[model samples]
Target: MTNAIQKLYPSTKMSIVLAVILFTLMMPGYISQYSVFPIFIIIAFISGVGTKFLSAFIKSIFVLVLFIFVFQCFLIPSDTVIWSKGILTLYKEGLEASLLMTSKIIAISSSLIWFFLVTPIKDMMFALEKAGFSKKFTFVIYSTIQLIPQMKKLSQTILEAQKSRGIETEGSLMIRLKAFLPMLGPLVLSSIQQTEEKVLALEARAFSATVRKSSYYQMSKKPVDYLVISVIFIGFMIFVWWRFFK
Candidate 1:
């Protein structure tokens, strides 16, 4: 996380921002098609205007969209509305497939951005507490979220180390997959070792104490939280009304 980001979100605020961003992004999937394009444009604007994490999320969106296009063009059931160009016919059924896939692609992209960048991991856990989660469960959830990025980087390091040691299985496609075994085993072992160390450290600190703990940056739902949440709820209702009842 950038220092700027850290300073901006003292933990709780980041989580609420992330949650709202995700909710707004998913609005397209839950409503009629009339709102889809407009929401898409808004999300695109968000991504485009962002200086950080924008390109990565955009690249992910493109990858998903391109895969969807391939699947729709080649795998969907054929129909009579095929565009016949000499020997090739592009089926109309593919259009529906493409739209569905596009929806999924955009939704997933938005979610990744909101959760990974817009929200800090600490803030996410804090928000979970506000949502009535038990402290123990929230601790575990927060730990896991923090662990993932570390784990990914560790896995990459392990893979590179194994590759450097001439652990080459590059000939056959199956052999290439089997090569992952070397990396996976070491990574899992490393994770276990790290977990054991963490457990001991937690135990030393009396982490399992029954006494309640107070938060320095306490997460209380302010008037803004309620006001923001209410606007979202009402917007959702109105969206549904316009979609189904209009």
Candidate 2:
């Protein structure tokens, strides 16, 4: 995202608008689960091209989808049996429910993560502002984008530290639950430490006191920006009409 994006999007606003359009298109009704495959292929290319941690990024998506599927298996209330071979008779409705939930979860997550990778946070926030979104809401979006990576790293660090400290995660479920508390302790502490560092850095840089700070890379809209915006707007209107009236 840092090094790869070089005016591929005419401006920050365009990239964000494109991202939102992709997000809407990936939904279940706007596009079916089967058709989402093509969108994901494009997403894979975009994320691969934009993000630096290609392996981890790709792996995270698989993990995310798998987790959603497994969670669905437990949470979905279905009566249809899955299998009738040997001693196994799985519920068909459960399987359908799991697949449906998994499709939605995976598509939504992939679309969002791909967008974050391909579009810079600054560009996204500015785009939201240009699109008439309130600054307060946009600020939340910006801060969340900035903090998620830090929180992910801190989570991994905590998990690894618990593993190294012999937390007995391989034991019974009860023991694992007990171990979770201690692991959460370190995660909390590290998160607090990171927040403090962010505060100090903000203060040192006079982050909010002075106004009219200049950006090093200004994003002036190009002809492509208008084209992309128009397409997205037209597409959105079509979708809304189809959803509400058709």
Which is the leading candidate under TM-score? Answer: 1
Q: How do the residues 1-246 of candidate 2 rate in per-residue lDDT, one tens digit apiece?
A: 444333345354344435454545545442375455456556556446534434544677667766665555545546765546664455666566667765665555555555555666676566566666765577677788778897888778888888898877777899989988898887788777887888888779866664544445456667766776777678766867776678
Lowest-scoring 10 consecutive residues by lDDT in candidate 2?
4-13
How much does candidate 2 score in TM-score?
0.55
Clash totals for all candidate models: 0, 9
Local distance difference test values of all predictions, in order: 0.62, 0.61
Name the candidate that leads on lDDT.
1
Clashing residue pairs in candidate 1 are: none
List the candidate 2 regions with Cα displacement exceeding 4 Å: 1-31, 43-58, 63-78, 121-210
The C-alpha RMSD of each candidate to the native structure, in angstroms, is 5.2, 6.6
- Compute the lDDT for candidate 2: 0.61
Residue 115, model 1, lDDT: 41
